[model samples]
Target: EAGVAQSPRYKIIEKRQSVAFWCNPISGHATLYWYQQILGQGPKLLIQFQNNGVVDDSQLPKDRFSAERLKGVDSTLKIQPAKLEDSAVYLCASSTRQTEQYFGPGTRLTVT
Candidate 1:
């Protein structure tokens, strides 16, 4: 099977600017996730979707970040007025129930 696909492998932006990252998961995967990994920490789950419906978003920074899965196939993560603290690698992953997640290459965001 083909792996997950993400666009713009790298991004650099000024603080308070806006950015968006796109992802296309493996065909037929029912669960999609977005995660953020800072320099020294593990990837933290930012949001999760089960077939176009959000399952968890408590960890997401609602004030500035948002995400959605469309038709349960493609997903996008967006940050508006991004902060310096938001500089991180944004990863997209997908899986079936109770299965291992396949991650994309990730979009590396740098907020100056």
Candidate 2:
């Protein structure tokens, strides 16, 4: 099976700038998620979507981060006015039911 795909493998931006990342989950998956993995830390769930409906976004910084899964297949995550702390690896994952998730090669963001 094809794995998840993400674009812009890496990015560098100044603090307060905005950036967007894209993801295409494995076909047929119904659940998608966005996570932030900082250096030396495990990935933290930022948002979740179940067939285009948001399931969870409690950990997402609403002030600067927004995400959407359109038509239940593709997803986009955007961060505006990014802070230095926002520099991290942004991961996209998908799963069926409650089973294991398949992760994409994450987008590494560097904020200077």
Candidate 3:
């Protein structure tokens, strides 16, 4: 089976700028997730979507970060007024209920 796909594998921008990342999940997967992984830290769940509806987003920094899963397949994560601390890899994953998740390569952001 194919894996998740993310575009613009790397990005560099000044703090306070805006950046967006895109993701496409594996076919027929119902649950999708977005995660932020800072260097030396484990990945943190930023959001989870089930069939285009948000299942969880308690960890997301709403003031500057936003995400959406459209039609339960493709997803996008955005950061406005990006911060230096926000420099991290943005990962996307998908899974069936009660199954292990498969993650994408991730988008690495470097805040200058």
Candidate 4:
């Protein structure tokens, strides 16, 4: 199977600016997730999708963070008016009910 794909592995922006990250998960996976990982900390789930519907987005900061998976294949995460504390690795991962989860390299965002 092909691996997870992500782009712009690194990004730098000033506080209150905006940024977005993209992800294309492996073929045939039924579950997708977007997570924020702080330095030296475990990844925290931001949003989760089962097919094209949102299964969970309890941790997502609705005021500034938003995401979508229109075709259930590729997804995008956007943060408007980004904050300095938003600096972290944004990871995209996928899994099937019968398989283990796989992660992408992640987009590391830095806010000044």
Candidate 5:
């Protein structure tokens, strides 16, 4: 099966600027999750979607971030007015309620 896909691998942005990331989950998977992983820590769930419908988004910082999964296959995460503390790895994972989740290489964000 094809693995998850993410873009840019790395990103550098000034504080208070804007940036975005993209993701494509595995085929036949219905559950997709986005996670933010800071240095020296575990990945934190940012948002979750099941077939175009959000199942969880409580941890996402809506004040400066937004996300969408229109077709339920691909998704995008955006940050406007980026903060210095917003620098982290944005990871996308997918599962079919069975085995371990497969994660992408991730987009490493650096805020200057």
Candidate 6:
């Protein structure tokens, strides 16, 4: 009966520094997603996972970003050598088959 959980609700880092965000999806949910939202823009799906396998990652910046779902339960997203453009809110969402998604409180990253 719990929603997704994300760590370090806010982060501040210098450009080029690395950062990682964690997410724990709701129980019994089979789909998990990671999204990025910049100011004034809607959230963009970065990666999606069905269980522990990747379903889509076309929008993910592979050169600087990576994500993984562990044992079909939890996930982590990492951005290495972060850019100023990477400053945004990272959102985690999960859903069961044929159902609406539940979102986390998100991690807000500030690149200075």
Candidate lDDT scores, in order, read: 0.95, 0.96, 0.94, 0.95, 0.92, 0.96
- Residue-wise C-alpha lDDT for candidate 6, range 28-103, written one tens digit per residue: 9999999999999999999999999999999999999999998999999999989999999999999997378899
Q: Which candidate's TM-score is highest?
A: 2
Off by over 4 Å in 6: none
Q: Every model's Cα RMSD, please?
A: 0.7, 0.6, 0.8, 1.1, 1.1, 0.9
Candidate 6 residue pairs that clash: none
Tens-place lDDT per residue, model 1, 27-81, is 9999999999999999999999999999999999999999988788899999999
Model 1: lDDT of residue 72: 84
For model 4, how does the per-residue alpha-carbon lDDT over 6-29 read when each residue is reduced to its tens digit? 988999999999999999999999
Choose 4 or 5, whichever is better by TM-score. Answer: 4
Question: What's the true lDDT of residue 96 in model 5?
Answer: 86
Segments of candidate 2 deviating more than 4 angstroms: none
Q: Could you tell me how far off, in angstroms, the CA of residue 66 lies in candidate 3 after the best superposition?
A: 0.5
Runs in model 3 with CA error above 4 Å? Answer: none
In model 5, the clashing pairs are none
Q: Considering only N, C-alpha and C atoms within 3 Å, which residue pairs clash in candidate 1?
A: none
Clash pairs of candidate 2?
Answer: none
Task: Write the residue-wise lDDT of candidate 2 on 1-112 in tens digits.
Answer: 9999999999999999999999999999999999999999999999999999999999999999999887889999999999999999999999997678999999999999
Off by over 4 Å in 1: none
Q: Tell me the TM-score of each prediction against the true structure.
A: 0.97, 0.98, 0.97, 0.96, 0.95, 0.97
lDDT of 5 by residue, 1-112 (tens): 7799999899999998999999999998888899999999999999998889999999999999999998889999999999999999999998888366889989999999
